[model samples]
Structure formats: structure tokens, C-alpha cells
Target: MELPYFITWSKQKAPTTLELSKNSPHAFHIVEGSTYRPHLKKIVDLSSMSYQASFGLRNKMITEAIKKQMSLFSIALPKHTFDLKKEVSLRLIEKAKRYSPQTGKLSKDYKCFYTLSGSEGIENALKMARQLTGKNIILARKKSYHGATMGALSVTGDWRNDEHLLPRQWTVRIPGPEEDPKGEGIERIILKHGSNKIAAFCLETITGGNGVYIPHPLYYKKIQSLANKYKIKIIMDEVVCAVYRTGPFFGIDHYPFLKPDFIVCAKAISGGFFPIGCVLVCNKLSKRYDDKILSCGLTHYAHPLGLSAIKATLDLTEQRSFQKHADEILMILTEFARDLSFRGFKVRHIGHLMAIEIQDKLTIESLIENGIYASIIRENLILAPHLNTPIRLLKSSLKTLNKLLSK
Candidate 1:
């Protein structure tokens, strides 16, 4: 058979059979035996940690989902279809409802909508906000990352998404929580734009991508007060921070007093088993679309297989043992981050998520040599490990990393 060729992210050419490993540096693709070192799939998905599920790997959960899906042989339909209620879609919806904090009496009401990825979920949130409020402008923070799609890219403040930034005039970028921790700039922007003209304020409860930057202690509360006073919907992008990644069901859960109108989530929701994104909205917002038609959907709006994967992943993460493991991992990550800081590395972290500013690309190369798959986001190294990653592996990797830094 003839060999296959592929184009790299940099537009370079290479053979598809190159070593079976080192092909997917971006985590967009997974190469088995190499990506999840020491312990095949176990390392990549250690419970509440990072979920970089690559294709071609079938763990027990994935196999079960596949089996269930094949057995049912259900037709693909829009998730809202009432006729499909008896199928896997209903189970997914019920599971989603259990995960949504907005459904409680004390909290703002919520409804769940499933998407194919984080970007789609974010786009849906923006669309919902604009349609419901009949406003065009959106408020996003500097250094924030919601997703890669046009609508999401337009609102993203980081440079990575700059190439995809189209002329979306409605998104207003404000300084991040680190710069305007008190959210004073948000109020100024709201006033300047005339609150009535603004559809929503989009924010990452804990900013990712640009480095895992935690928000100022009072940031959410201040933004919440501002949004409430002006009747602007608050869209909290918890895509990377939910599903126990940051010690909460939703990242916004960190701020109990604040009530964001929308929550966009993905990643860990399926425990890295499938590509899926979810939008959880307040009851008030859902009512707006109850009679009116929603203006967003994709071909795979809610794939049954994807929903099955989500249900299985949620079941795994919600187990008491998994929760305890996650708690322990958080502690370990906190101490690990502190040690790195003492070693003169600039570290930023919240819960199990962390980012270290390692400016040299060679250090990243060195990390790979040491068998630690570190995610390099711009100038920083994302050091988030799976919740079930062996503690010894982490320590060894850290030691190797520190040695590399010393040199």
C-alpha cells in the first residue's frame, strides 16, 4: 500500500506513519502509547483532571458507549425533539439537569442544550443572549478565551485567536480580572454603551489559555451586581473550569452570591471521552426561547453517541471515590505549584489547573524528552495532570523539569 502524507499545523509536510507518536503536539489528535505515557489511557484521564481523549483508543467507558449506541440504532434528531424522549437523549438531558446548579430554588433557573464542542456552546450562549435581550453588543474580558469559532474568536481577547477574528463589532473587550479585579471597568463600559443596547457580559469565571489566571476575589460579585442593575445577562464561560476541574460543579460556584444568566461548559464534562459542549441557562432565559425559535444549531447538535459518552463520564466523575480523588489532586497541585514558584518559576493556578511561565521552547522540548507531556500555551506551560495520575509520576516529572530549568 502507498504511504499517506499529512500537513502539520505549520503547513509543513510529513508522512502519516512517522513513529505513531509525537504527531499530535497540540492535543487536537491523540497518538496512543506515546500521548499517555507509563499508563496508556489512565494517565490522560485520571478522573477530574485533564481529558484529552484521542481517537482510536477505546477504554471500557468508551466501548460501553459505542456498544449502547450501536445496539439502539436510533435516528439522529434535534435534541429538542419530543419524539426522541424515550431514547438516550432523555438520559443525557436528565443527567445534564442533575449537573446544572441553576435549577435549584435558591439559584437562578436553568435549562441545558448540548453542542458538538466548546466553541459551538459559546456561540450558542452569545446567540441566546442577543436574541432574548434584543441587543447586539456583548462584553468580554481581555486575555479571555471562549473558543475557536468566528463568534467565539471575535470575543476572545488573547492573540492566538487574532487570525480568526472577523469584524464582529458588537463584542467589547475589557481588562481581565487581574487588571480590573473589582470589575469597575465593566460598569464604565456598560454605562458608555448604554446598558439597554448590550446583550450580555461574557466572562471566564477562571481565565484559561492566556494562563490559568484566577479572578480577583470580588470580581464576580461586582460584575453580578452591575449586570443585575443594568439588566444585562451574565454569560460565564466555564468551558475549562467545570466538571470538578476547579473544585466545583460549575466554576461560578466559587462565588455563591453571584448568579450568572448562562454557563457554557465542555472539556471535562465528558471526562475527555467525546467532543461535546453544553450550555446551561437560567429559567428566565429559557422562557424567552420557549415560544421563539432559537437561531443556532449544527448538524450534530446532540449526537446520541456523544450524549451516551457524557452520561457515562458524568457517572464516573460523580462517584464519591472520584470526588475524593479530585480533592486530593487539588491539594497536590497546590503544593506542586508553590514549589515551582519557590524555584523561581512564575506559576498561576486555581484548584487542579495550573500554568507556569517557561519562556524557552527548548524547555518544552526537554520536558517531552523527560516523558512528561506538557501543554505549551504561548509562553507558559500548562501543568494540569489527570486527577488519577500517579503522584510519583508527577513528582518525577517536576524534578526533571526543575533540573531542566536549572540548566
Candidate 2:
């Protein structure tokens, strides 16, 4: 059977043998909290996409929240002149404040701008940075994934940007700390191009998708200093690293000194059940648009259903048990990574997000054959299991991974 829709990032238009069985329950289906596939009877998903299972699949709390909101009001609440005050929206804002670095109990130092997806969040952040600074150039790190949109893609430093025929004249690429520890490369670019020409320094809190690369602590300090000196805004892309994926509420929280102008996030915010993205804007930048028209929005900017999901997810995070569970998962992953390293495999991780360096394709194939479902980026196999996965199951999965790696 031929599918009408084009699959993104796939060269093969025709479905493979695995795709053929997608509809069969015995082949590949996720029921309740577990995934089942033909090759791997009960697959353990360690992909970052599995973060949705933070509260487990088909969570009653999130479902009830969405259903309750849907019953009470119109789901599509577009921005209009006579906009009604939404309690869900207000609650979401209050809940989000806890995760923000610039927001405080009595401080009105930040505001949330909602979008439909992480890509939209990035697009809007880029737009606001350029609009606020009146500068065109955007400095982004190499091997980073922001989004698929043109503005976000322009700043992206991977093969995803290679397909575009148009030139990205305004975006500049900077090397990671591994190559330039003191941020000399970024300073050179800023000085050579003139700081006045640059709009923002956009980067992921921890480089995701292109391998989980965590830079040295001083690397963030150096860049923040540069941004301050150059008067350029800092945009921290926490699309994947936010929501306790990195132990901290926000990945940027790990670096207490750096405060970004825009913190863009999505994925796991609404428990991955609803599609929603947010740009948490510092009051310093947002205040400039108080009287002026911000001129950016979407049809479903802050849909009540998404807001409810956000509320439910945030409520779960606020639970004492949830925080303790996250801490436990972090310890488990840290030990798992250490064990892999002791066995001669290169491992990198922060909290539950991890990557194992593998040169042989068979290792990945073997893992998949044995019921481990993970994502591969170049030579790195990403192992980001759901934060709330059972400890027994997680350890069992790790044992299988260790056995396969030993081969």
C-alpha cells in the first residue's frame, strides 16, 4: 500500500517490511504503558520521544484534565479584541514561573508566548530577537538542531540545513567548547562581524539530536559574558532538555549565572500528550513591546486543552513523589553510564538523557532485535527512557544493552 503523505527526512518513499506491520497489534502496538513489536516482543523505548511516558501512557490525570477543559469551554480560543480571561492560561503561567530563571514570586520579570510546536517557539524567538535588536545576524553553535522552519534551519548547523538552495547570509556558526574552550571563536565572529550587526546567540542548553553534547561549565560562562559585552540577546533552546529531563527543572538552571533573554521549550511540557511550545521572555526584552504591537501569533496560540494538559503536567511535576522519582532515575542513569564506560564504551549523559557511542551498525541492530528501541544519531545511540519507567524494567533493559555491547 502506498501512503499519500511524504515522510520527513526519509529518502525511501516506499515502506519497508517493518512499516508493513505497523497496523497489526502483534507487530508493533503500544497499549497501556508498554510497546510490543514483532522483532522485539516487549520493546523498551529509550528514545527521547518516549519522554511522553513520564507519567506513563494513557495517564488518567492528563486525560481527565483535557476532557474537563473541553467540556467547560470552547477548545479553540483565538486571540481577539474581546479576549476572555482564561483561568487555565493564568494557571499555566503561574506554574511555568517555577521553572523560569527570571521569574519570581513577586517579580513580574517574564511572560509566556505559546506556540503549537517547538519549531514555532524557535521561529518566534528568532523573530523577537531580531525585532528587538534591529540586527540581522544570528550566531548558533555547530551540530545543533533548532527546528525545520527556514529561520530556525538557517541557524541549524547540521546536514538538515544542507538541502536548502537559498543562502543563509545573516546566520553565523560557532564551534563548540571542545575546539574553542574560552569562546575565542565566538568572540572572533562577533568582533569581525561587528557586535552591532548580531541579533542573538542561540544555542541548545545541551545539544540534542546531533548527539548529546554537554559543554564545559566555563563554556556557558564565557558565552554569557560575550553576549553581555556585545549587547546581544541570548536564546536558550530547551525544547528537549527542559521539564526535568536534565534533573533540573530547566537545563539552564544547571548554570545559575547565565540568564537568557528567551528560553524556548516544548516536548514533555504537556506530558507530550498535547502539542504546545512556549517562549519564556524576560521582562527586559518583553517590556519593549508593551506599547508596540508584537505582531506574532497563531490560530491556537493558547488553546484551553493544551493549557489544561500543561496544568496537569505541571501539577504532576510539583508532586513530592515525582521529584524523588526523577532523582532516582538520574542516579540509575549515571550508574548505567559509568558501567558502560568501565566496559570501554563511550557514554555521555545528563539525568536520564544519554548517548552511547557505537561504531558498528550491528550493535544497534542487535539491540533492536533484542527489544531495545533507541534513536541513532550518526554513531551515537540515544537512550532517553521515560523518567518514570519502572526501575526493574530500566535495569533489565540496561543489562541487555551491556550484554549486546560486550559482543
Candidate 3:
């Protein structure tokens, strides 16, 4: 996909590498400027776009604030994502959206719901749950992150931050079947707490980004049955797994019979642009969601730019077969994971994902210096390469890792 615009700074120099690093989103050097800034006021600045600026840097407010407040001087923003000399976020967003055909996976009723940022969407979903059911306490599984927003962190499963890092809301964390709860049942927990205080239950479809840990058989269906029996609403958080990252658009597609009240999704939405996450409410929940201002609003709510990206993404998804993409990815990851497992590594995978706990392995910092920039998930490196990135790249990455490990 063509980027929205091009850069034309006279002092611009070519870059050495396409891969972005922390200091430099891309490798570049400066050409001698014809003139010099005599003072701080004369510095030129830029944003994502490569436009002329009067400030000497981009995102100076943040950089200067951090430098003075934190007492540290550093470059965190890359010229591409951050410190570019122009305001081209919209261009970056559009380019990102078009760069990948499949933005996200969705449930049956989606492709019609409004998308918002992750925290924004989660808060709205919870608000809807609160208003419709009139239940004060929201239950979520432990070790999950809805978002960083006020109301979102409330229902977030992780308690490490809730006590001081977030606001106090009527939130409860329910142990999943894996947590080894006291009883052999979720029904027991519901019966003990009673459904009157609990408005809704939210959990990821496959526990992605949280470990890609999937629940056992009849897990969701049982949850659905319990909610029905107790008159509580069920919401599935498919945000991480909603994109084509997992085998299906919506991981909950594996559990349609569960008939969740709401599905919150966003990752890979617009292929990482537009920050378009949505809570796809069901027919029943839709009727209950009403004319109030939604109790949650962001300046970028349904922003035209994001909506445009989403519409284009969805259109591309329909035109392109993301399922095929998922299938191919699954096959590749499965083979790679199986090979790792065959070598005595504790390899586990779901869909096109894999997380292995290989001990006495190579460290994170060394791998990068070796030119392998992988998302280090503890001892396991998270490898979800872009679909457009060639299979050779994946193979080369794995081969390089294996070589490094051999040393």
C-alpha cells in the first residue's frame, strides 16, 4: 500500500535499514543544514510526516518533559512512529491499514459494530453490562488486562496494579478452571456469591497475549449455561485473538453455541492502525443498550479516520481470504512448534500461535545484537510475523535463533 505522503526535508539522508529500532524507527543520518538554530526558540520540529518544522526535534514537549522530570536524556520516538517532522499520523494509519489485508477477526454479528480504542471499547461494554443488568460487581478471570483506562482497569484481572494503579469499581476476579479453585465448579462460585451482585462475566476466547492459554472442553459452554441459569450476562473478550492471528476471525467462533452477550475486539483491527476495537453486542444486548451518552467517550470516538480504515480493512477482508492466510500461518507455526517440541522443548500452540519454554536458552539482549529482533515473552520469543512478511523471513528467523542457541 502506498503511504499517504512522502518526506521532502532538504537535510534528509538515506536510511541504512528498514527495521525500526528504539532510537531510530529506521536507520538514518543527517545532512548538514544550510543554516543553524541560534537558540531553543529557533529549533525545528516534526511529527510522523516529513514536513519542515521550526523546532529542532519532534515530540519536543514529551521529550523535554521526560528529560527534565526524569533527569534522563534519551531518544525513544522513532522518526516513523513518533518524531517525524510532520503530522502524518493519519497517513501512517492509512498506510498501516492497507499494508495488511486482514485487520481482525470478528464474531457473527460484527462488521456492523462501532470500533474504539481497547480501553474505550471495554469500558463501554462494561457500562452496557452494568446498565442492562443493574449488577454492581463485574467478574473477570485473573491475570488479564482490559486496558489502561479508568473503568477498564477496574474489571482487569490483574490485581498487581488495581490496589493503587486504578480506580475502585465493583470488580471481582474469578479463578478459571486452570486456577485450581477450591471447588470443581464455577457454579459453586456463582452460587456462593449469587448472581444478583454479578452483572457479567468477561474472559478472553483463547487467553491470548496472556499466554495463548485456551480453556478446557465445555469451558465456555458451561459458562454460558451458568450465566443462563443464574440470569447473568456473558461477555467474551476476543480483543487479542480476534484478528487473523488465531485460526479464526473470532476465537469464539469455536464456541458459537455459547451465545455471548458481547464480544470485545481490536488487535489487528485495521491491521494495527486506527485503534479500532469494538464490543459487538448481541440482539438481546442491543435492545438494552440505549440513548444515554454511553457513559464513555473519547475525543477520537468513531473518528472519521479510524472508521475509514476499518471500512477499508473489512472490505479487504471480504475481498481477500484471511482464513487462507490463517491456515497457512497455522501450518507454518505448527511445523515450527512441532520441530521445537521434537527437540525436547515444551512447545505448546493454538491456531497459528506457539509459546515454548525452552530452558538454558539464549538470552533476549544477545539475540537482538545478533540482528534478531523478536518479542521476548520471558524465555519464549513471541513470533507472530506479519502475513505479508515472507515465509523465508520466518524460516530465516528460526534458523538464526537455532544457530544462536547452538552456540
Candidate 4:
């Protein structure tokens, strides 16, 4: 009999094979005595990714993170609280109150105007800006991914979705300086647009998918200062980079001197246990107008279940200083990259993330075929290892990779 043309084909005679070990609660149907590890399922989830990445390997790491988050979250609420939306919002309301000063801004010192569950949050950000600022054009960086929703897509610069017909408007996508121009070019770009016509300056703290190209250390400080100087509100998009992923509570913490009026965060806020996106606004922007309707709200905003997960995640990082740990992670990563380089795998772990630019596409395919996992980073392979990833396991994976490269 010929083999099946598709991916995997087990022994046809015993196609439904189930071993005695499989029946045991502690074990499952793993290929017996197989030297090479089996391929793990592809991770197509953007939700699982963020500053604090969710589990990738189909193993305990994912389970443990979820279980730990859920345990604290479930304990926080009463049983039978399945509808997590409203409760989640109420929790945010309380959290915001803690941050907002009692008497300050026109927008409630303690109240935020918007909370988007997904991409709609980005759409709402622009909508609110136009409603308040009365400016139609929104400023964004070149090659930005706001969201797929119509309004969010409007200000985006990613060309992958160019064919995707949405109510999109082509606007100014200023070229990021090839050598970190220190915000000189950005200020000139804003001046070019006639600041009165532009509503907001929205950008990522550390550019995502654009090769994790973290801006120069002074980038945000200069940008935030400029937005203030020109009366243009800054909308810092921290969707993938915020929430302790880079070892800081917020990726903005990396640039402590940089103060933005509004900051958008989503991924890792709920620790991959639930959905939660928040827009943290400082008093400066919040005080813009008197009783102006934001005209923005998501039906699932402040979802209780989602909020509970966020609360639990916040609590987990409460005691742990994410910033220090992130710096340490950076150091450890630098060491790993050096080792890979020693064995001849053109590697790069710069910016806030790590990407190994290998010799060719075949090497990537071969790596995935091995037990180790990663994704394409520009023309390289990305390794977004979890905070809990053990170095011993990484070393073991690298040894195998070295052998494969030599072969």
C-alpha cells in the first residue's frame, strides 16, 4: 500500500493504535523511542503574544500560566460569574480611580473615555480624537498595524491589508529615520501636515513586527515633548510591547522621561487568560473639554471575566519588578546569541526582542522540524521565549540546532 500523500501517516494495519501507557492519566500516545521531537502545532494567535507572552509549546508551560492566573482570578470573584464583561469593567473603574487624581481634568480625573476589547479599541481612539479635537487626519508611523476594523484600518500603514477593502483613508505615514533621527524628522513631518488638521500622534513605543525595531532611547521623550509643544496629543500604542514583556510594567517605563497623554495596551494585560485592553490617559489630555461625548464604547468593555484575569495578572507582577527581570532577560539573551554565533547561526537579539537571521529558509524549516520552535522575524527566525523558559532547555535545543547546521 502506498503512503498517504498528506502530512502524517501512521501504520495502516494498526491505524487506531493505543498503548497501555496512553491509558494512564500521566501519559499519552507519543511516538515510542523517537529520537527527534514531534512538530508542535503552529501558533497563529496574536492574542497569545504580547509583552508577557502566553505558552507556545503544547506542554506544561502554557498550562501552568493559565492555571495560576485562573486560580487567583476565580478566587477573586464569587462562583457562577461566567459573564465576565460588566464585572471586568467595574474592576477597571476602581483601578482607574486609584490612578486618577480626585480634582484635575475635565474628563473625570478617575474615569477613562474608552476601553476597546480588540481592534475596535483603536478605531474608538481615533473616533474620540476627532470628536474632541475636530481634526480629521490622524498621524501614524510607516508600517503600523492599528487593527483590521474599518476606522482603525483607516490610519494604519501595513500594506498586507491593502487589498482588504475597508473604509480606509491614505494619510501621512512619516518614514522612521533609518538611523534613529532623534525625533527631528518627526517634528518636521508634523509641521509639514499643518498641526491644526491633524488630531493625534499615534505610534508604538517599541515598533512591533517592524523587526521589533525599538526606537532610539531618546525617541519617545522627544516625540512626547514635541506633541506637547505642538498641542498634538500623543497616543502611545503599547499593544504588544507593554505589560512586563520587556520586564517593565509598561514598555513606556523603558523611557521613564517620556510622558504621553494617552497609552493603549492589550496583550498580556490579562496574562493570556482573558481579553482586556485599556487606554491610560494622563490629566493633560483628559482635561481637554467639558462634558464632550467620547462616542466610543465596546459592548464587551470591562468584561468581568476578562477583568478578573487582568486583576490576577496585575497581582502576579505586583511583587515582581518586571523591569529588573526584563533587563536580566536581555542579558541572558545576549549570551545565548553569542553562543549561536559561535556555532555559525547569523543571530540578532537586539531591540526589545530576539531574532536569529539564519543562512536560509531551509534552516528555519529544519529547526521547526526539530523540537525547538520559533517564527519568521523579517528575513530571520524569532524566538519569543516565555519569562519562565529555563536556560537548560534552551541550551539543549541549541546543541541539537548546532548538530543540524553541521549536517
Q: In terms of lDDT, which candidate is strongest?
A: 2
Alpha-carbon TM-score of each model against the true structure? 0.83, 0.88, 0.68, 0.70
| Local accuracy of candidate 4 as per-residue lDDT tens digits, 1-407 | 34354322234553532212221111112243344854223222212233345322233433455565466553332223444444444554443332213443333232344353436557666666677777877777775776667877666776645766755453566665344557667777778878888778777766665555666766666776877777776676777666555545556667655656666777666655556677766555556645654455656555555565565555555544543544555677778778878977776455245656654644434554464445554465565555444445544655665576567
lDDT ranking of the models: 2, 1, 4, 3
lDDT of 3 by residue, 49-131 (tens): 11111011222232333334234322222212322212223322322221111444332242124446666777777888888
Error of 3 at 56 (Å): 31
Displacement of residue 29 (Cα, Å) in model 4 is 11
In candidate 2, clashing pairs total 0
Against the hidden true structure, what lDDT does model 1 obtain?
0.68
lDDT-wise, the better of 1 and 3 is: 1
Q: Which candidate model has the greater TM-score, 2 or 3?
A: 2
Best by TM-score: 2
Backbone clash numbers for all candidates listed:
2, 0, 18, 11
- How large is the C-alpha RMSD of every model relative to the true structure? 5.3, 4.3, 13.7, 8.2
What C-alpha lDDT, on a 0 to 100 scale, does residue 347 get in candidate 1? Answer: 89
Q: Give the Cα error of residue 88 in candidate 3, in Å.
A: 24
| Local accuracy of candidate 1 as per-residue lDDT tens digits, 1-407 | 34355443233443332233222212222344644563222122222223343211344765587568768853476754533324444443343342334555454556777788888988999888888888989888778877878888888888746666384689887778778878777788778878889988888888766788888768777887888788888888888777666677667667767777777878766656667777877777888777888777788776666777766766667678877866776787788778879988898988777788888744534554454556676898776566555556556656766677678
Model 3 residue 61 lDDT? 33
- Work out how many backbone clashes candidate 4 has: 11
- Cα lDDT, model 1, residue 350: 80
